[model samples]
Target: MTNEQKALITATVPVLKENGVLLTKHFYNRMFTHNPELKNMFNMGNQQSGRQQTALAMAVLAYAENIANPSVLIPVVDRIGQKHVSLDIRPEHYIIVGKHLIASIQEVLGDAATPEIVAAWTVAYNQLAGLMAGHETNLYEQQTHKTNGWTGWRPFKVGKKTPESAEITSFYLYPADGGKVAPHQPGQFISIRLFLPQLNLKQARQYSVSSTPGHEYYRISVKREKGANLDTNGMISNQLHDFINENDVVDLTAPAGNFTLAPDIDAPVTLISGGVGITPLLSMLNSLVENDYTHPITWLHGCRDQSVHAFRNQLNDIVKTKDNVKQHVFYNQVTDENREAGVLEGYLDISKVPSLNLQPNAHYFICGPSAFIQKQYHDLVGAGVNKQHIYFEEFGPQLLSLN
Candidate 1:
């Protein structure tokens, strides 16, 4: 809002446009070189995949756009706050990042890096830093004070590994410290941190809690990352599948995420998921069943085959126990003869989605690959679903745009 702030934002626009990628690269390099400890805080694989780079670039642009009207950027700030908390990003780290970032800009701009330019950037950086610091503080405070299943990383030990299919496995996690765990609402995600030996880095990934919140333990179903071929395995997921085992201790950041079940018990709920995207919906369904909510619930899940379908038995059990819950499975590749009889034999046709027992005031939750979510999102919106009522989560870096 200040003239200095306006000047700073104005001066940085051309620089960011011209050398954003280079600045990001240099900034990260400098940051990691100076604070090797931070290497553990970020996803190296995401860095290599160029996801982190793009996210930073986008964030800077967003910040610049909202320089005069920072309030317009609160949602962006809130999301970044959640991510920072999930990653255990602290205020001190911001200072470090800012220093390195300014140095990188100076290194890039050379003689053009006048005192005024540096002062403007300094003010801008301080303003952003204060914003981030406040956001993080509030998040931390909430996590600390909240009684229900919301909190920072808690120690959990693996209880069971139930095989969902060839590529998918479900993990039951119980608190290792014997502390009370908060009950999470359906459709929320928990951030899991793993110290990978091979990569020598602490990597974090968000997994939808597959079980209802009232249970004694948390469950997450993960699909093993089958690389494009033999060349590119999903770094965090594959490592978890291969290395994690029953009784192993894991750290889980509190149940956090905005995607959640509809609060109104009267509103119809439709869950659409693809492959392992079924994790969150399964949790919601279980919650609905446990709480005996009378709202009609339809689960339309798409997978390759029965072999890869997660929670087949559990879903069947729900259909049997809950009159309000219905399930439709689509198998892209069906090999099993007996169980494959009534299963639809292709991907979900988004156009036909609206005809699937949907109610007029239905709320929808969708999770899958970027393409799947995007296609279904368009289809749902096209079918006159209120955009506010539709919630979705994308599996990987491809979903960054949604963030």
Candidate 2:
């Protein structure tokens, strides 16, 4: 974009900060109305809860705020690229979004949107769309080139459904084509699309792969979401829990995510999780154990209690057999037996555990709620852990900026 266009976009940062959600809401509404079929590609649950709008607002505000130096937003771009590829988002979708976005800006800004300003925003949107499309193209190419990999959604049949806890259940998905599946990075997720009869539309949700790679099937442990009154936050999850079953078929995109463990790294590794966020971390931990990683490995988890702690026995067996593996469990409520077994009560507090390896060479991976990840990140940094070595994955949109 030209210097004048950049200046215009920078000047609108305040507007974006204040009214970005309003703009994005308008954009989605307009786009969906014009192209109803495109709704199949989006998470309608998030759309209903306004989470998608809020996430898009933050992204737009961030872009406008850093219009002069977009290179600084490379991390955000890469993260979004991974998600887009997993959803099978293509260049044509970008064109649709760009058109609706420009029209939404013109409609919402009204008289304030001078022709010059609109022209500038159009250029700015095209530039960002171009960058994101290019990045997503590369990701799609890489994913399709992987062993047993293919682009777009592939049919997978639910081979088995096992209850992990009161709230969480594991679904083992096998290729309906009866072929080998591509391996995924330990912390990666796959996009599963299911038809929602209530909305009479298809919706997609990304769930972290909980099982170790190389198996004939990919496993995703899902926590049934019970939304509060009038909330649509867990529509897809509830559908999976209530209706979907073994032998049922669903469409899924290949695994894609940047938050993954490096099996080759010979450093102390720590895996931390809260609530159902343990899914991806469990994959990393299991893969490490399966590969016989020699470095010291630590697992820290926090949840309600024993009844809700998924994979309790499996984790216990690993701790008992692996000398290099150490486990720490924090419960909101504890029993006498838990106290006898070294289970700590209350939330996860790293400071209370001095025996944990805090060396700079150690790599820490955390997956959990946004607040949980933020607190863990700050605590790790405060405890003299290198910031670069601390990585986290948020279940929803990428909102937290630790830097």
Candidate 3:
């Protein structure tokens, strides 16, 4: 962009921050009204809960805040690119979003949005879109060419659905075409789209592949969401739990996510999770077990109680069989058996667990509630673990910045 445009964008950063949500909410409304087809591409549950608007607002403000030096946002951009690819978001969708976004700025900013300002924002939007499109294009090329990989949405049938815990259920999915499935890296997720009868529209949701890779079927463990939180009260989750059934078919994009394990890395690996965040970490742990890995691996988890702890026996079996694997469990409710059996009380306080010693070449992966991930990330850093080795993925829109 020109220097004048850059200066103008920087000058509007405060205004963007103040009215980001208002602008994005308006943008979504305008986009949906004009392009009703997008109703199939976005999570209507997030829209209802206002999470998407808030997240978009923050993203817009962040982009405007760093208009001069976008390189600093490359990591975030790559992360978003992975998600977009998972949802099969194409260049056309970006065009739709851009038009409405620019219009929303004009509408929300009103008299403050002069022609010069609009042109500058147009340049800024295109610049950011170009960066994201480039990253997504590369990702699409790499993924579609990989063995057994396919682009866009593929049909999958629910072979079986088994309840794992009080709130979580595991769904075993087999491709409807009966073709081979790609071996995805542990910790990656797949975007599943289904028709919502209530809204009479299609919506897509991302769920972590909770099973070990290399199997004929891809498994996703979904926790039925309810209550006020957007993560739990998701319409898709409710649809899966209450409406969908075995033998039901759903559409899904290929497995995609940047958060994954490097199986070839000789470093020790530590996996930590809270509540339903265990899904992806479970995939990692199962991969280790399936491969008979000899590396020192530690599994740490926290939940409300034993009844709510999904895969408790599966983890116990690993602890029993894997010589190099160590496990620790923390319960919110302290109990006599929990104490006698070595389970700790409250959250997984990393400082209390010395068994997870800071190995020089160890890598740490965490997934959980935003607050849980943040606290564990800080604790991991405080425990002498290198920040570079710490990797995390939140369940919902990212609310915390590790840097």
What is the C-alpha lDDT profile of model 3 across 250-357, one tens digit per residue? 998889998999868678899999999999999998888788788899999999998889999989998998899999899999689778988989888987776667
List residue ranges in candidate 2 displaced over 4 A. 227-233
Report the error of model 1 at residue 73, Å.
2.0
TM-score per candidate: 0.89, 0.96, 0.95
Ranking by TM-score: 2, 3, 1
lDDT of 1 by residue, 6-25 (tens): 86677678778777877788
Instruction: List the global CA lDDT of all models.
Output: 0.77, 0.90, 0.87
Angstrom error at residue 114, model 2: 1.1
Give one digit per residue, the lDDT tens place, for model 2 in 174-287: 999999799999999999998888788888889999999984889999998764643233778888899999999999999999999875778999999999989999999999
CA error at residue 150 for candidate 3, angstroms: 0.6
Clashing pairs in 3: 225-232
Off by over 4 Å in 3: 228-233
